[model samples]
Target chain A: MRHILSVTVENEPGVLSRVAGLFSGRGFNIESLNVGPTLDTGVSVMTITTEGDEQIIEQIVKQLRKLITVIKVVDLTDLKSVLREMVLLKVNANDANRAEILRTVDIFRCKVVDVSIDELTIEATGNYEKISAIVGLLTRFGIKEISRSGMVAMKRSIQN
Target chain B: MELTGAQILLECLKREGVEVLFGFPGGAVIDIYNELPNTSLKHVLVRHEQAAIHAADGFARASGKVGCCLVTSGPGATNTVTGIATAYMDSIPVVILTGQVPTPLIGNDAFQEVDIVGITRPCTKHNYLVKDVRELAHVIRQAFYLARSGRPGPVLVDLPKDVMQVKTKFVWPDDVKMRSYNPNCKPHSGQIKKVAQLIRDAERPIIYAGGGVITSKAHESLTWLAKNLHIPVTATLMGLGCFPGDDKLWLGMLGMHGTYAANMAINNADLVLAVGARFDDRVTGKVSTFAPMAKLVHIDIDPTSIQKNVSVHVPLVSDCRLALEALKEELAPSLAEYDFEAGHMPWVTKVGVWGKEHPLNYQASETTIKPQSVVEKIHEITKGEAVICTEVGQHQMWTAQFYRFNEPNCFLSSGGLGTMGYGFPAAIGAQFARPDKMVIDIAGDGSIQMNIQEMATSVCNNLGVKIVILNNGYLGMVRQWQELFYKKNYCSTCMDAQPDFVKLAEAYGAAGFRITDPGDLDRVLRQALDTPGTVIVDVRVEREENVYPMVPAGASLTDMLLV
Candidate 1:
């Protein structure tokens, strides 16, 4: 199972590398990782997605909590949350295939972000499964290239 | 006042109230070595890098403060890796600093250059690579904060050579910027009551204490809780000193080589209250069969440790000190009715009978001083005030068996890592941490030589450590195993020519004593203890002596074959 760990750490030089070093050195395979500054000036939030057995995940979280720079670590797999992923796919498209691609795009609710003589770039945002399915349907027209921002998640606000 | 990075390091150390540092000097760390002459801080120069770190670990374990070690990069830093990992596993506070090949040559893979920060990240609580000269003071301060705070583990700082040379204005931070390192020490009152109620109703209650009790300084509270609740106390290897061995209520250690009665008691107990102990596999064999009749109550400062090993019925996430105190208070009012009963008296009597039957008897000869005799004599002379450190193998087990540790932190051994050559350096570290107390390393010939280089450190720093070496001509422990399982195929366990440790000590500018006769055991120990600096007692013992009452690894705890 994939477990998402949300960690807050002090923003300082080499902090990111230290965190990455910990995972790699300990032989923990990180599936996906995203880190950026939060509202706080000196604190940064890192959302790391790791696939491991329950015990391994628990060990990883426990060890991560021991890091001095880390402020808080929350395993969000058990919480009610919203998870999102973004994927940009450029597919072969001309008048011949454009109508079929547009129909497929409309079904997946994807917006065409760019267009060229031989290709069209469709931007889609949703859960990973949804993006993968849309990309699978558009592959018939020949996928020119693809870029994906891995899963990012947070606990949905109670009011929402 | 102008300050160098070395001086800034000293001031940072002073703020953390560190009085001693164990290390060795090399070309890269010469700046710190030069600055050492001008400071009040005492630096112990171990012969090997590994011993320095072990000694630092011993200091931390003995003093409940962050222990510090300094070394140069590359081999010096690499050597301490095992020691650092050992401290990390046992949760002892240690801060290690390695001088690097100047910043310019770091990435060039210059001579004596090693990525100490990257190497030690997993084994350390945290680590810093000092790139900017201005960050030295802050990094040093941070090292201490990370080491001694929260769960308490080793932290390392790799200082580039150029950074040490660059002159920097220094100011120690009153508090570091670790927003996430807060360790929860406060006991939840609700959980305390639940534990107390469970203890109150337990027909057969046992309290299993581990090293955390010693680390948290919760001996008094633990004893109070055990006594107030009329609970039997069993210690893990690390927990040996938490409860007085001579105390009637103490059930001795629990696990593989643990007493039969202690294991039986834990096996039959209705409730097992574990304080600061992780149920290591060595302690709990055949997990499905272990303590089958008991419901576990685990109280640890680290929340993850509570249910990591054994399934716990009640988990209290708090420091041992606070939880124990709270448990004592809650159980104090109604505890009298549950005081020691006739059933446990049989166990006490049975052990007493076993002692009388076995008598810890070892034959004394005219030509050699028996290791057992030396241990007994030390115990008689020290009156249990001295702390004993032991290296791994036969001597470690023998020390654990023979020496009665009546106080917590009185026994320091590499129980988790089982590292050889750990004794002398650890004793040096323990002695420096507690200058007023007597510290001795009960080491075997094979184990002592692994880190015997530490004699230099003891002598140079005037650590006042006493090393009582049980010098058998062979690796006695391995020989015993070979004798038992390998048809006496000794292979290479035998030593051809042993260095005269007496001369070795003298070479290091320290005192030396020789114990050829068993009659001189007491006198030799007393003399060594009275000496101002380090002393090595090379005791010739029977080469075939073995530590017994060991249940072979695959066998049940009850399947011990006594030799």
Candidate 2:
């Protein structure tokens, strides 16, 4: 089972290493991790995606909460949450393939951020499935370069 | 008052009520050392950086206060790594202050510069690197707070040379408010009620305790619960003194080298109430089959320790003392309704039978002294009241087996890390903590030499720490392993050209003695104990003696190799 954990930690030096060390040292595999400053000063929020069984995931969450810098950990997978990832893809698009590429991009609601004489750079932001679908379509036109920001997530507001 | 960073560091320590500091000075901490004479804090200069940490750890364990040490950067900082890791493993609270290169030279590969914070991240509870003088007081305050709070462990504060030189107003915070690091010290009442109900219905209940019990001062509660319910108690190496060793309900130390009765009781238990014990691998050999018939109720302060190794049915994340107190409260109302004698008598009888069947025994020789007998004599001479510390290997096991510890903070050893050279310096620190008590370090020949230089520290401080070296001339534990599992292929385990430990002690301005015959062992030990200052007594023992009732790795606790 895949699990998304939202962790809030003190924005202190070497905290990232401590978090990463806990996962790697314990032999827990991390699929993706995104970290940035939270709204509160001196606090950072990290979203980590990992797959494990019930026991393993329980251990992971408990271990994360054990770190002195980490404030709170929420298993967002069980709750209603929104997750998003952004990817930038530069595809080779000569005259012969430019129209087809633009059509495919339009169908997927992606934007062509930059255009050169021989290539078109497109930006897409969505869930993992949506980003992967756009990347798969762009591969047909020969992707010259690609960069992906790991998934960032949050719990949805309670619905009364 | 305006003060340099070094002066501010001393001021914070004094305000924190630190009376003694164990440390070794070098280049990075020259400024601090220069300012040390002005403060009232007594500093015991150690020979090696590692011993400084270990001594401080011993002081903390014995006194229930955060141990403090200071060392210079680079190799000096790195030397304390093993000691810090040892303290971290046993959750001993210690604050390590290390001097680093100037702030500008931190990452430039300057002379004697190392990233102490980066190196100790995995081992420490928390660590900091102070780049500015203004933050020094705050960081020091936070370091002490984190080191002694909740699940206590070592915290390192790396001070750059320039930071120590900068002048600023020394302002110590009255309190540290770490929002994220609050440890849950109170057990939920509902969970306690559930566990109490389980205990009421349990046919064969066993209380498994660990180091947390000692750290949290829960021995009275643990003993009350066990006696009230008539449950047998088994303890880990770190928990040896947490329960009275002479109690009839005591199943001597449990785990790999645990007593036969303790192992069998754990094996046949129907309900295991694990308190403050993280099911360490040594404790739960073959975890799948461990307590196969038992429903485990684990109570620990560290949440991660609950399911990190072995899963339990009921997990209570709280301080050991608090949890035990709550459990006792929950059990009080239901106590009158339950028939304790009828429920647990049979189980207790069975455990008692196992205890008598294979008691820890060793034959004493007329020519050579047996190490077990030496430890037994020490226990007898001290009336089981001495503060006993040990280095790793067979001597440690013998001391743990033979020494009957009836009080908390009486037996100190490197339990989790099993680091050698831990005992001598630890004995010094323990003596400082309890000046009226007799302190002895039971060491093996191979282990005593690791930090033997600390004999000077003891003599200089006029500390009466006795070191009894069980001279087996081999790394006895490994040799036992090779003899049992590897067909007696003793590979490089011999210490043929070892130094004369007695003379070595005399050279350090301490008394020294050597006892070769069994008859002279007691007399020499008594003499050494009566000596005014530090004394080392080397007793040549039977070379082939091995720790018995051993369980091979991956074997169930029930399976034992008794000799």
Candidate 3:
């Protein structure tokens, strides 16, 4: 099972390595992770997606709590949440296939952030499914380069 | 008051009540060493950086205080990694101070520079690299706090040369609080009540204690609970001294080289109160079959340790002492009504029979001294009062088996990490920790040489630490495995060419004694023990002797190859 661990840690230069070391040290590989600053002055939140059983997940949460800089850890997978990812791709393009590429980007609600004589850099933002779907469809277009911001997550809010 | 970064570091250590520091001098640490004479701290200069860390670890385990050490950068810093990992694995509180090259030269691969913080990140409980002298005091304070606080372990503070040489206003941070690092102390009352209820209802209850009991000072409570409830008690190797070894309810040390009684009791136990101990593979012996009929109630300070290896039914994440006290309170009323003693009598009696029938033993010979006999003699001569340390090998197992520990912090071994060459230096540290007590390192031929250079440190300090080498001329533990599983393909286990330990000790200006005959064992051991200086009594034991009552790695606890 895949678990999305939303971890809040002290915002320090080495905090990322400290948090990431826990996973690697325990022989657990993080499938996808993204970190960003939070509302608090000296804190940052990290969203890590990893595969493990119930025991391993429990162990991971407990181990995370042991870290000195880690403030909190919550399994976002157990809660109602929204996950998003952004990926940019520089794909081969030409006059013959330019319209097709634009249409494909248009259908997926993506944007062409950059363009050149031989390539188009497409910007994409969506959940895992959407990101993978777009990447799968663009494979035929001969991707020149690719960059992805591994999944970021947030708990859903109920309006008052 | 304004002080150099080095002075500030020493100030923090002094405020933390540190009296002794086991360390070695090097170029990177020259600044710190320069400032040492201005302070009251006593430094025990060790030959190797590794021995310094191990000595500090031994001191901490013996004194129940944080052990501190200082070493230089690069190779000096790298030397302590094994010792750091040893302490990390066993959860011993040690504060390691490593000198680093100047901040500017750290990443430049300057002379004698290495990224120690990055290297030790995974092994340490927490670590810091002081970039500024202003933060030096705070980092030192916090490092000590982390090293000694809940679930104690090694914490490293890397001191850059420039940082140590700089000056800063010494502001001792009284409040060493890290918002993210507070360990849960009070276990849930509901969980304690549940554990209490389970204990009251259990017919065959057993208390499996570990080093946590000693770490949390819960031995008294553990003893009270086990005695009042008529539950049999077993300890992990690290937990040897937590419970009185001679107590009738004591089933002896449990796990791989554990006694027949301890293993069988765990197998049949209906309820296992696992306190302060992790169910390591050595202890669990085929996890699927471990405690097959028992409902495990694990109480540990580190919550992760509770359910990491085995499935825990009632997990109380709290200090062992607090949880044990709470459980006693919760079970107070029920204790009067529950016929616990009568209910547990049958099980305890059965365990006693197992102990009696298949007790830990060896074939005695008048020609060659048996290692087990050597341990028994040490226990007999010392009256089980001395602080016992052992290097990792069959001798370690034999010492754990024969020398029954009746007090906490008396038995020191690299239990979790099983690091060889740990005993001798640890004995040096233990002697420093408790100068009044007789500290002895029961060693094997292969392991005694690892940190054999430390004889200089012990001799220089005039620490009367006795190193009793059980010489069989082989890496006994690995050799035992070869004899058992590998068709006797001895491989590199044979330690044929060995130094004359006694002569070597004499060369270091320490007493040396060699006992080759069984008839001369006691006389030689006594002479060596009575020596006024550091002594090495190398006892030539029966060759090819194996530590038995063995449960092959993957075998169930009950599946023991007993002789």
Candidate 4:
């Protein structure tokens, strides 16, 4: 199963490498990762998505906590959580299927950020499943380009 | 002040307070070497890139700090794979910096280009291929952090030549934030109590200590638990020195070359309390048969390590130190009135008789001393206080059989990987980690040459590490195998006669000695012990002696074939 870990760590030198190091060192695979400053100074929030068993995830968290620079770790996947991702995809939608693509975008509450006679670029944000479904629907429309901002997540409640 | 990526690499190293580096330079790494002249860090040029990394590993093991090694691209980086793997297996903390081909040539396979990040992935704790100069400082800093933080192991950074050449403004990050790399040292109290209860109920209990005891500084706890409970103790190769060799409860090493009594104890014990040690195949010897009679109680800092290799009955995944502390609490109350006299005497006597008969016996020629005798003499001189490091092969086995290590982390060697050229650098690391203690490298002839270039590291650093080479004329262990299994076909087991180790040491400005006479063993060892600087003792030992009590590979520990 995939595990999403949201970690708050001391904003210091070598933290990201340490995280990546832990994964690669132990031979764990990281599917995606995103990091940014959190609400507090000298603290950054990192959301890491990886696939492993309960033991491996526990080991990863335990090892991460051993670093003096790491402050806390939260397995967002294990908690009730809110997640978001921003993706800007440029697709070939100009003269061929512009009307069909616009209609599809409207149905999914997505926006047409850029447009040309032959192309209509789409911007959409939702949960991972929703995003994948949107991308899956667009695949039949002769998609030209795609990109994703892995995942950024937080718990649903203040208690976590 | 703003700095270039190269400067930032040096600056971050400075911030980490790294004083010295061991490595060789080449075209790709020339830029970093060029930047070195302006920094306060000292770099030692070694003969081989592998030796350089091993030297850094030695420093790390000795000092409890991350050791640093630098190498250029392709072959230079490839040469370090063995040393990196050695560190990974032994859990030594080291940061390896390898130069890479220019970014444009990375995929083109230009001259001296290698996919180092890919090659070293499994061997390293983590690795990076830096394409952007802006991330150089963060990468280097993170390498150090990851290398030294928890269950410490080697980390690699492959810097593309282009990134090194590119000029960029550098700002040292105030902090590094990563969600996936937290390390915890604390043990759970409840789990510890359950383990203590198991230990209390265990009638035939044994403590299996590994290198973690030394790494966690839990020697006192191990000693206390063994003595208070009257439990016999056995060690994995990494666990040597966790308890005094002179202690009656000490059953020496437990595994392929382990004693029969130790193996029996592990096999028959009701509870096997394994602390700080991983159940490596070399130690388990046919995992299914290992400790067949025992219910395993495993305690380790890394939770994933528990039950990964061998099944555990009671698993308390925590640091050895914390687990020991918590165990002390639970054991203090439930402990029954124990009488060591009746239960331990017969076993002690049997081992004593075995020791006297075996006596680590070997033949010493009039012109050549025996390596076993040299080890015995060293043990005699130091009273086993010295921290001994060894390379792999027959000599490592001989050391395990003869040397009586009484403290934890006092004996360092390559057990799982069994890598050669591990001795000198690991000893250097061990010495650096514990400067007040005497550190010696007991290496075989074949093993020494594998990383002999580190003479420069010792010479430059002025570390008083004693290097004792058991100079048998052939690759002793492999030669033994040939004689036993291949009808003495010999093959390429013979060395290039012998290297002039005395002249070699002198060339590096270190003192050297060659002991060909067994009579002079005691006298020469005394002088080496008194010498202030590093001394290389090239003892000419018998060329054909084999380490006995061998269980071969893939055999049960109970089955042994002696020469």
Interface C-alpha RMSD per candidate, 1 decimal: 2.2, 1.0, 0.7, 6.2
| CAPRI tier of model 4 | incorrect
Candidate 4, residue B404: lDDT: 89
**lDDT tens digits, residue span B1-563, model 4:** 56666788888889987877887999999989999999998777777888788778877766667899899999999999999999988888899999998888888978999988777766777777888999998888788888876688899999988888878888788887666566667787778877877765666778998988888778898888888877788888888887889887788888877876777667767788999898888788888888888889988877667767776888877778878977887677645554544554554465556545544456656676777888888899988888889998988988988898876667778876899888987777666668799989999989988878778777777889998889887888999989877999999999976779988888889998988887888898789778988899888888788887667777777776654
lDDT of each: 0.81, 0.92, 0.92, 0.81
Encode model 3's per-residue lDDT on B420-534: one tens digit a residue.
Answer: 9999999999999999999999999999999999999999999999999999999999999999999999999999778888779989999889999999999889888998889
- Candidate 1, residues B362-450, lDDT tens digits: the string is 56666766677678788888898898999888777777767878988889988777788877788888988888898999998888888
Q: Residue B335 of model 4: what lDDT?
A: 52
Q: Would you list the clashing residue pairs of candidate 3?
A: none
- Return the top candidate by DockQ: 3
- lDDT, model 1, position B300: 89
State which candidate has the highest TM-score. 3
Screening candidate 1 with a backbone cut-off below 3 angstroms (N, C-alpha, C), the clashing residue pairs are A71-B180
Residue lDDT tens for model 4, A1-160: 8988898887865678777877887788898889998777789988888888876777777666654456788888868888887677777775657778888899989988888766678899988888888898888877778878878997876654
Segments of candidate 3 deviating more than 4 angstroms: none
Q: Please estimate how well model 1 matches the true structure, expressed as its whole-model Cα lDDT.
A: 0.81
Worst 10 residues of 2 chain B by lDDT: B333-342
Candidate 2 vs candidate 3: the lDDT winner is 3
Docking class of 1: acceptable
